[model samples]
Target: MTKTILITGSTDGIGKLAALKLAEAGHQVYVHGRNADKLTSVIAEVKAVATGAAVDNIGGFVADFSDLNAVRKMAAEVNEKLPKLDVLINNAGINTTASVMTKDGLDVRFVVNYLAPRELTNALLPLLKKSSEARIVNLSSAAQDPISYKAFVGQERLDDKDAYAQSKLALTMWSMDLADTVAADDINVIAVNPGSLLNTKMVDEAYGEYWASADKGANILTELAISDEFANDSGKYFDNDIKDGAHGDARGEFGQPHADALDKEAITELERQTQTVLQSLSA
Candidate 1:
């Protein structure tokens, strides 16, 4: 069965590769990017690689995720264009930037990596509910650190790594909470650490080195998006970096998430702070 999938930050890296793969498999693939030119080019590229029938199924959206209002507008556009979304992949993230502060005075990493995705997911919940089964794959990381509420709400400042790690942890925490909140609706929410340092633009800019190919991460994303193995795996975290004796191999299997991701106290605190931030944004 062909599925309708939307992948954010899909103009490049694993997100783009996954979009191409899904499009080739005849799924209705919606690719998103921050740049309009890039989005147009990627849509064309996906269409080029897609099979005969799937060629017409490729589409795209453009939004600068650093701005919450932009994310909201993009969500409205998505709701207008897509009747139902079978899978939503929150793949856009950043650890290195020319400026770390958004115009809203929040850390760029936090706003783009966590807050924007949260807002987008919530805004699209109704459409997702329309599907018999829907999957939400949040891109997490192995670099999670404890979230500082002051920093999270922009009261305090943090360096790039600190902010990025906290943002990912916050996202993972929210994923677990959201999974339970929408369990009755059969909307599966899963947090995924694609890999420690796969060969992606973000990794190259941040670490200058990679341990695996981006395809390794894209493969797991494609699986989680449609494979039946994860039908009942909501609220779970898939760590693609953990496989015994597969450390040097790029094709390692997935494992459980960091202990903090499953901690109720931490997750509750993250939810509380996230709500506070969202409310402040609205105010």
Candidate 2:
């Protein structure tokens, strides 16, 4: 079956590779990027690899996740244009940036890696509910750290790596929370640590060296997106970093996330803090 799928940050890295492979597999893929030109070129590249009618069904959207308003705009466009969405791959993330803070006064890493996806996923719930079985794949990290309340609201600052880890943990926490919310509606939300130090631009910028191929991450994402193997797996964290002990195998197994992700009190506090931040964004 050809399912409609959307992959955020598909202009490069594992996200791009996943989009191309998914398109080649004949699924309707919607690619997104922060730059319009790059997004257009990526769409053509994705189409080049697509098979059958999927070539005509390829779509593209451009949004800078660092901006909450831009995320909202893109969500509105996606809701209006795409009838329904079967899979949503929240693959956009950053470990470093020129500026630590976005124009919204939030840490750039938290905004792009966590809050943007949270907002976009919520906005697209209507379309997701239309599917027989919808899947939400959140790109988590093996670097999860305990979130600091002071830093979450932009009251205190953190180093690049700290912010990134905290943001990924935040995402994992929310993924678990959201899974319970929509389980009855047939929406399965899963968090995955694609792989540690894959050969991607983000890795090159942050670590200056990578230990595995980006395809290792892309393969797991593709499987999670469309494979019935994971049809019933929700609120679970897939740890690709555990594959083959070190260098990583494309096929990963389900594993546990940080301890905080499983804490009822922590999840409740996270939800409260998240709502407070989001409400502040509107105010």
Candidate 2: residue 105 lDDT (0-100): 85
Q: What is the C-alpha lDDT profile of model 2 across 47-120, one tens digit per residue?
A: 99999899899989999999999999999999999999999999998898899998878999999999999999
lDDT of 1 by residue, 58-131 (tens): 89999999999999999999999998999999999989999988987889999989999999999999999999
Report every candidate's CA lDDT. 0.89, 0.94
Model 2 misplacement above 4 A: none
Q: Enumerate residue pairs that collide in model 2.
A: none
Candidate 1, superposed: residue stretches over 4 Å from native: 244-254
Task: Evaluate model 2: give its lDDT.
Answer: 0.94
